[model samples]
Target: MTRCLRRIAPLALALCHLAAATPAAAQESAAAEALFDRGLADMEAGKYETGCASIAESHRIEPKPGALFTLAICESRWGRVASAFTRFGDYLALYEQMTPDQKSRQGERAKVARKERDRLGPLVPELSLSLPPGAPAGTVVKRDGRAVDGALLGKGVPVEPGEHVVSTQAPGGPVWETRIQLAEGEKKRVALQVNGASTAAPSGGISGRRTAAFVAGGVGVAGLVLGGVTGALTLGKKSVVEEHCGSAIGVSDETACDQTGIDAAESASTTGLVSTIGFGLGLAGLGAAAVLFLTEPKQGEEAAAATSRRIRARVLAAGPDGVVIGARGAW
Candidate 1:
């Protein structure tokens, strides 16, 4: 009696669990049927977008050959040739797995699906992709944001008619992207290339920034020396003018000067102008040198080179009248 009761208790629990799940299953079936009906109504009203969406949802809730076939039809009328073709193939495949009685019921729909799939086979566009010679190994290719199989490379593969984005990336290389458009029944091939070489300076070497800094420093020192020499010459000329023309350093009495005094004053003015220009060049060069040295990149020669390329310094000696020196950069 005790053994019998144990067996019976297990059976009772199983039955109770089945009963509890029955209502949920029924609810799902009801919802799927409702969606299917609504989708059909929408498609008949020429609203393919909403109709297809509803039907797809209904198929997701409860997969059925009828719903899939209807969805294929909706997609066909909506001009999604690739989608319609794939869905029709799916319906035919599903029909093959149905039981004898089920197959009998779905035979007509299966025939239509096969016919449609065959009709679209020639209308679908094909795209072939190939890598350029010397392409790096482990390169990844994608079409429309989906990964493409390596085996499909250089082979014509079916694609939907319209615009598509193709992208490729190799190890340690920059991503390459291109857009392509195809019409129905069109076939096209594309050759992809990757720019993988680094543009940075080589390792274990002086960076561009350092080189620029040295150049700027040298210019600064030279400018300073020129300014000093020119300034001394100006001072000597000024002394001569003062002695001959009764002109002090800041005060010039031209009426009290003869030709020699006037000549001395002119020489002093020209030398003073050269001195001023030299001083300006020296100051600007030194400032640029300081900034470059302080902001030099520490990553590597390559990074420094990239950073230095953005910075530019120009110095022009405009025939001793004035000197122009300035630096421009991104940051």
Candidate 2:
């Protein structure tokens, strides 16, 4: 009986130790979950700042990032320029995991983007127009839809007869100068850009996403290398522990000496594997960037070709509203 008791004592004690560790781990996880939920709620409400904080805290525990994306969109709507930049991070994280199948679809998306990017250039206001008889009243000069303060009646303001530009500054956007012309009547139309690298002429294929993938993938690769080193060192520690303690280390002894070595090895191995994945992701990102760079111009050319919309009118009139009088022409 004494011998049995002695043998069982260590096992029971170890069990108790393990049991004590469980609640702490559970509590930590619960806290992380709570934070994540709160972040999700904030994101839905468009409270980006609060959402970001909650998500970041939760991420430390769970290491996920849906909340970060929600926050970025909210910030963009509010015109929070700085936060918009932070939102880009969420896209970068997700992109690192894209497979070849996903990347293959990028070309199609790039084509559409390029088409829109160069849809129009700065409006060149037409000069020396002969005003027709009975030109309609309330003919407001517009460049893209706002009031062009102090734009000259005789001075140049870009137009294409269907777009509007009512700006005080230079119509600073691709299609910044509109073609919306007023016939002394009125028209309503609105178009949205998919917000590429912002400039009057968008850098069609930037998508801003490729750059992020490149950076994150690089970081992941570096982490892999670091993890590999750590794993190697931990293995050495494991050797030392086994040499000194033998199999007894994991038996009823539970001296904690071998525990350190085991923990080190586990941590190193886990991180090392993760690091390799990161490294691979990094390389892929860089490669993707190269691909995107080469692809954009091709896409842009296609888009331009498509937009070569020619006009073929049998007969027409000439007026401020475009041949409002008697004329015949082709576009």
Candidate 3:
């Protein structure tokens, strides 16, 4: 009795395991069938994207011949001719491996798959890529973000008709990339080259600070000349006032002044005010020019220098009384 029980123990355990697995397998099949039905309904309603997604998931869960054929049809109708062609080929291959009874049941679908595959063969687009002579070894070429087989280079490989991005990069080199659009049955050849050198910065011109410095210096010189000319005229007018009014050189008593003396004094005041304004402008302009020239940026430090130093100088107001020079800066 013990010997008999030992012999039967393994068999019973196997049966128990099989019975336990059966429900899970049945649930998966049921889920796959539901997804397949939903996919068909969605496709009928002209929702190809979602339909294809559901069908693909169904096929992944249970790779049934009917589901594969239906998925191929959905892909074809959705404009993915290459994917449909590949799926149809897969279905036909699966049909070849089916038992006689299975083959009999799938015979008509197999015929349709073969016919569609053949029809799409000539309509699919092809892409051929190549590298220039003397291209570096280990240069990787990619299409649509996936690496392309080196053996496929220079060979016309079938692809789906649409836009594709082709890029090539060598080790430690800049990536060279291009975009290509292909129509049905069109064949295109692309030659890729690695760009080893980086783009260079722009070449020489006058720096902004130097230009501003030159302008300020010019303004300063002009102001100094105006101040000198006006100063001399003021001295001549004061002499006239002193001579006509019998006033001392530095005296300000204008009560005894004649018309000539009053006019001379008024002219002197005008020239004197102008002199003061010109001198003020000259000093401010020269100081600004000096600061700008001294704080000019060195090579490769232009941006840092700009942020570090900011100086502005201008004339605020000028009139008979006096002139105002305004200067603001940060170091």
Model 3 TM-score is 0.57
Cand. 3 Cα-lDDT: 0.83
Decoy 1 TM-score against native: 0.56
- Leading candidate by lDDT: 3
lDDT for 315 in candidate 1 is 61
Tens-digit lDDT track of model 2 for 255-290: 344656566556656655554544444444444444
Candidate 1 minimal-lDDT segment of 10 residues: 197-206
Tens digits of per-residue lDDT for model 3, 189-274:
98776676322123345666778888988888888889899999999998887777744534466556777888988998888888
Give the higher-TM-score candidate: 2 or 3: 3
List candidate 2 segments past 4 Å from native: 1-257, 298-331
User: How much lDDT does each candidate structure score?
Assistant: 0.82, 0.47, 0.83
Tell me how far candidate 2 lies from the true structure as C-alpha RMSD in angstroms. 42.2
Error at 69, model 3, angstroms = 0.7
Q: Rank the candidates by TM-score, best first.
A: 3, 1, 2
Query: Each prediction's TM-score against the native?
Result: 0.56, 0.26, 0.57
Candidate 1 stretches greater than 4 Å from native? 197-331
